[model samples]
Target: MVLDPSRYQDHRTWKMTPGLLRARQPYFRNNMIGLAILAGVTAGIYSYTYRFLHKDNDFADVPIPPIDEKELEQLKKEYEQHKNERQ
Candidate 1:
């Protein structure tokens, strides 16, 4: 069951074998890996943006609407009358 050590002795020479010369030469860059990295970055940025925008609740800077107290009272009376008529 002993294996020959001579077969694997020339490890560097295996890359220069004549028939497999094409495999030894460097090839073009892979687009899928680059695209996957870009997608991951974009998703991370979008997630951060969503979290940033939704994190605030107390919007104190915005101006409140000028509501008239008399008009609100009249509206309430009208609503009550409408409800009574309906019943």
Candidate 2:
């Protein structure tokens, strides 16, 4: 049987129809809201993490103890003794 072009006249191309757009409007709106919330939460978490990581230390003004030569020699002797025992 031969197909007739006139019989297919009612069918249109796959362009967006008004009814389809209307049906998907709520879904699109919800997705956009969810995306906005996700973006806001991500930004907040990043900002908080950056601030936590880079904040000024409370102990920055404390002075470090000077190294003692007597303590260094004692530690070296202890380390050598320990190494010999381990071997």
Q: Write the per-residue lDDT of candidate 1 for residues 46-82, one digit (tens) a residue.
A: 9999999898878778898887999899999999999
Report the poorest 10 consecutive residues by lDDT, candidate 2: 2-11
TM-score of 2: 0.45
Each model's lDDT comes to 0.73, 0.82
Candidate 2 at 51: error in angstroms? 1.4
Best by lDDT: 2
Best by TM-score: 2
Clashing pairs in 2: none
Task: Write one digit per residue (lDDT tens) for candidate 2, span 1-87.
Answer: 454334324336535566667778889988999999999999999999999989969899999888799998999999999999999
Kindly report which residue pairs in candidate 1 clash with one another: none
- Model 2 residue runs over 4 Å out of place are 1-22, 76-87
> Which runs in model 1 stand beyond 4 Å of their true positions?
1-29, 60-87
